[model samples]
Target: MKLIAVTNDRMSIDELIQTLLAIEPYIDAVILREKSKTDTEILKLIQKLKEVNFNVKKMIVHGKPTIANTEQIDKVQLPGGLPLPDLMRQYPALLFGKSVHSLEEAIVAEADGAESVLYGHLFKTNSKPGLQPRGTDDLRRIVSSLTIPVYAIGGIRPSHIERLREVGIAGVAIMSTIFESEHPKNIAKEYYDAIHT
Candidate 1:
């Protein structure tokens, strides 16, 4: 199972770096979802990660195509509503990711040439409270329907990851659970273990 660790833009660069460092050793990719930081701030953080000799294997920048191009990260995970075709042409060199919430969206994303899709609400969490959990069955169906890689996102925990892997999910993208943990690397290790177990 692949692990995609997401960064919080609200945190200071120092905090963000610390968080990234803690989890980098265990995950397959680091997604910098900087929703509030300016482009310069985001660029500085990326440069800092590179400068420190961190092997940031794969990076998923939220939406900055121009900066993503110059920085040369692995991929760019786009928002749910953006046109993948238009952006794909703009950055043919980078992998394009889509945020998909349903089976139909997953099929559409694949048709639109998305390199991967992050599917969510697999389990309930504060991110989307009071909503029905999209259990393993739902995920299995979506995975089966799409040709592109499917990443299980939203409220994913170490315990739930193994089941996701059983159904052949490409990876898991996580936030609050890993990001808020005191020992995020250890938490990441837990996720890594779940993926392989």
Candidate 2:
């Protein structure tokens, strides 16, 4: 249960590398979720990350278990919309986490063999515009229905970590709070401090 931040392939390679390096120390995992990167681009990004001696073991990418398997990364996260195949159960391999916005969706993910689910929008977020916020109470209700770990997402920051901790959430997931910062390292530290507190 820890912070998992992702990088957008939208950034140039240099910017991408810098951001990853800056926040590496505070991150429990880095999810390389670039949607449009060609295979060559993806390979280049992976190689650059390795060159910096970043802990590749703590990395996860969407649907590319081949890359994760070959690179020996920590986990593989699948997009919420995709169906999890029966073959996933055979791996006994890396952690498998998925995103879900509803209790039913959460249940589906668990039934489909996800190790954990990323529950979201406890507060309205720009990334999830127009979606109703599920507040802490609703979040608690969702977590209580599942046996595996649940990580809270959407509008979470250093300030909100304690409330989530109080409710017994396994961890927190953040995206823009760290990525949009000029100093992502400091922001990550702030989130780590809040969670630890």
Candidate 3:
């Protein structure tokens, strides 16, 4: 299964770049999900990452098609409810992945031509405090229903990887488990090993 690292929006650009550099070897991709940062700031972040020789190709800009196009990064992870079909047509060069919270949403995303889907809060996580996790049964239903790749996200841990694989998910999208750790590289490697082994 693929091990994707998602930015938590809590780190400074420098910290993020350093973490990315350290974890790059283990992660399949990094989603730049800085919702509050301006487009200019996001552009600068990309530039900084490039300056450090981080692989821009592995970076997916969350909710920013124009920036992804500007940087020649071909991947963008879009939130649900947008006109995905129109966006796909507008940016034919870019590959779009939709973030979906439900099976209905996942079905719509697939129909709308999303290349992939990130679905979750599969386990209890601080990211969604007090919100019940969607759990494995729901995840399995979505996985079986969709023909496209489904990446499980939210509150995932190394211990959970085996169970996730059983659900037939294409991969896992992780945030706090890597980014919030004191030893980010080790944490990333742990997840990588779990998924691979």
Query: Candidate 1's error at 126, in angstroms?
Result: 2.0
TM-score, ranked from best to worst: 3, 1, 2
Clashing pairs in 2: none
Candidate-wise lDDT, in order: 0.83, 0.79, 0.92
- Candidate 2 lDDT, 38-137, residue by residue in tens: 7677778888899998788777777676677666775778777765765375455767888788889888989888988888877767677787888888
User: Which ten-residue region of model 2 has the weakest summed lDDT?
Assistant: 83-92
Regions of candidate 2 where Cα sits further than 4 Å from its true position: 87-92
Instruction: Name every residue pair that clashes in candidate 3.
Output: none
TM-score of each: 0.93, 0.90, 0.98
Pick by TM-score: 1 or 2, better one: 1
Best by TM-score, which number?
A: 3
Please provide, for model 3 over 8-110, each residue's C-alpha lDDT reduced to its tens digit, 9 standing for 90 to 100: 9998888888899999999999999999888988999999999999988889999989999999999999987778989888999999999999989999999
Clashing pairs in 1: none
